[model samples]
Target: MSENKGNAFDFKLFKRLMSFTRPYRGIFIFVAFAAIVMSGLAVLRPFLLKLAIDDSIVPKDSEGFMTYVILMLVVLILEVVFQFAFIFYTNWLGQSVIRDMRQKLFRLMTSFKMQYFDKSAVGRLTTRAVNDVETISSIFSEGLFMIISDLLKMLVIAGFMLTQSWRLSLIVFIVLPFIMYATRVFQKAMKVAFEDVRNQVANLNSFVQERITGMKIVQIFTREKTEYERFQEINKKHRKAWIRTVWYNSIFFPIAEMAGAIATGLVVWYGGLNVIGGGAVTLGIITAFIQYAEMLFRPLRQIADKFNTLQMGMVAANRVFGILDTRSHIEDNGTINYTNTKGEIEFVDVHFGYLEGEEVIKGISFKANPGDTVAIVGATGAGKSTIINLLNRFYEINSGTIKIDNIDIKEYTLASLTSQIAVVLQDVFLFADTIYNNITLNNPNITEDDVIAAAKEIGVHKFIESLPGGYNYNVKERGSMLSSGQRQLISFLRAYVSKPSILVLDEATSSVDTYSEELIQTATDKITKDRTSIVIAHRLATIKKADKIIVMDAGKIVEEGTHHELLENEKGFYRNLYEVQFADGGNP
Candidate 1:
């Protein structure tokens, strides 16, 4: 991830980010205007102070003094009003930008192929979409506005100071180079410190999310103490990173303060000498010069602070753009037509590897008619599941062609290919919503009748009906409210609701008890009757009725026949697996 050094702040990526704000250009323009007005108002404060000192206090004109006092009071009120407006507009623009960013990110994430999720961590992606975008929003709202205001204030103050007296202005301006040099050093140190802090913070967030999700496993294994120690190490690293940032800031601020102080002292000393030497300088002009000197350095100090914040924001931006920049190994060619698709599937000498040079499926071929039942049985990691993934194009084959209805799989659009197939995975995940919503997944077109019919077909309707709220009953995260078998049943129902042209059942009944397994087996048989079905089975009994069974061993097919035919051979891998299982008891 750290290799993103070159493209972190790429101009192209920044331009792409800016395009998201195009829709809200009006709000952004309003924010800019408010910032400029607020900066102009800030400049009036120092001028008012000079007026009070030189005109009111140094003179004996009481009548005119009250008018200046009234004018100063009015300017202060306007300053406060404009400051409020500035905050409102920037906040509005920031939130709008964040909303747009989140929507775009989520759309991109979901549009990506499954291979992206396989290679990326869920916690890291979630943090990027949620936390990183929020950080960018804060920078846009407060950090950006502060920068604009500081720059404008500095320019306005410089112009006024030069008008008052170029000699004194020159003395004050000498500190500009020192401030710039000091800020440059601080900026580099702060950037490194903030980058470390950001990395540590992400690590801590990932650790917490993983632990929370796996809390049951931790308690079950009695490894709470071990997990706590691991968490402590990560937390300590984050603390150290933050401490380093604070230490740099502590040193930087005082150096800046002392430099500003020295510049002020020089201005006062030089202006006094000119006055005593009979140079044309009055009390009012000297007072204004001192006021302008303070104004000048104040914005410079803000710029220093803003530089620190900008560095932090850049770190976040780099992480975000890193995600956006990753090109998924599997992507649509944009030429595939998805308007029509047939259900036929064929694998021709397909070879695949999850890692380089280690094939999981090697030169195996098979075909299934539009409505055929094909069963693949193998030991763990023998490539049964990989075949189904290939059929769905979740992974691209290293060699050979996968075709549907005699058309290459790559020629079909991803959406068209996926829409034709439904998979009930071994591990089920249900969102935190009502049973009806979980099944429909918020698809407005899916009616309640459709959900109930799918649930009934999967033999889970009775269990749902027993609940007080029935279809409206809410499931907790990951369906924790239900037992494992119940979750599987609901997942089966959800898959069935889609009514796909093809179905892949991958150990779909492995988690259930004997009674639920019998019920699910019956439901599975009924649902697969006339569909193009593929089953990856570990339990021999579950796939005994398959029309054709292919047994794989070490990434190649070792046997292919009916269940009885393979048992009769007694020399193939399928026969060996059956003997081992039935030898323990009657059947699994």
Candidate 2:
């Protein structure tokens, strides 16, 4: 995030990236071999031109001329073949690396704690996975090949020039140091410029994503014009960044051209004098030297261009590495008795916070028996959801201990803890897949009968059956194809299918209509009959049948009793919430 950071290309990071390609080392080696062959063949063309000029054209030898012409044709044919092989192998390597990186990143992102997602933007993370990976692919396929071929060509051409005419080669080499210095400066400038471009593009992408996702809010508030102006501002900044990048590149390339031209002009002037003075410089040798001068410039120019691309790739690499570098706030130790868990959950003097010095759950304490239904009721942001999040170990407690079956929760593997717990959140997020797939996401091998039974238990089977595609109905992105109540029903089915020992329902019935809510409540009662349940609800009426109810206010438990006992306390927060709901016509 810092603008003044040094070059984003870290050698250690590249070394780590290369490890992923180790599995396909054979392919990469073959790609490099082909590139070397192609570059070698490319250098042969200039030598053939020199041979034709000195042996055939100069001496008027038709037979020799025909032979040299045939040799040139053969070299061209081999060059084409090697070029094909080079492209094919590098393409294979690039795609394979892309696939490998995507898998690793996807696994890491999914395994990261919820807290990471809470602090990061979805759009930025998505860009790293998709756009950053693509930049790497381009580097491997095109940039890598250019670097190898150009360097090889430069070396071969320099050796040939020295062998033919060391004096002219010396003259051309005089400018080499200056060119290198200029290139180094340009590379540094381009690195900073490209990093700026990448950051600006990411900012623009984030803006677009946020606006699109919140389009409904913008329209409802009649702020479309304001949002458009905001987008224009971001767009203008992106454009300026791109223009600056282009301006730097434009100046760098032309300056490189001028340097090369100066070197060639000096070579031509000096070579003519050597030939005129009857020195060892032949017309063919001088011609080859000129060709070598032109060839030398090519590699320098290519190195410059490759550096620009490498800078962009490094910027992308920095973003991706930043994500991979983040240590998860919560990770389970590989110690757990998953095969036999009694499901006794307890929060003993737990203290927690989302930020330092600001506690969200202050000294909360509770114990749930193996089959108790404990409902937590509170106003929004009163730490109701925070309690359930802690129960699932999505966050680590600042103090005290959360124990499962008398063992600290941290002693259990995260997978073990999460697998034994099912949560139906307030906002259901269904993937763009079939309804059957969404419900069976945790247990893909679940039988069709089990799927139908889980849906029936959540009172969603009838609605699914009514769909034209039945259980195969597509949910679309975020369940946009279904109503809010139907999406909640599907989420309920998903949780029910898992049959977790601990079921946490956070506003699970808030979106459901009265008829569906009644059916789901009845089904929930039956399902939790022998399982521990923790329900967080704003609707006080929904948890009236709970075995125990805890009322929370300002991150502290203020009341604890059965539903009737809490209702009997006229001065309690729970009683006040109940009265307010009843006064609102008992709808909740």
Q: What is the C-alpha lDDT of each candidate?
A: 0.80, 0.83
- Model 2 C-alpha lDDT per residue in residues 1-588, reported as the tens digit of each score: 323446535677667667778999888888888877877887788888888989999999999999999999999999888888888777788789878888888888988878889888777887889998888776777776778788888888888788877899999999888888888888788878877788888888888888787788999999999989998998999999999888878888888899899998998899899889998888887788778898898789888888777777767877777777778857667487454356788888889998999999999888888888999998888999999888888887899899878888888788887888999898999999999988898566688899997777656788899987999999888888988777887877888888788889999888788877877686677667788899888887789888899899889898998999998998999999998888958664
- Model 1, 133-223: lDDT tens digits are 8877766666777788888888888887777678888898888898878877877777678878888878888889989999999999999
Residue 554 lDDT in candidate 1: 85
Error of 2 at 293 (Å): 1.7
Best by lDDT: 2
lDDT of 2: 0.83
Cand. 1 TM to true fold: 0.93
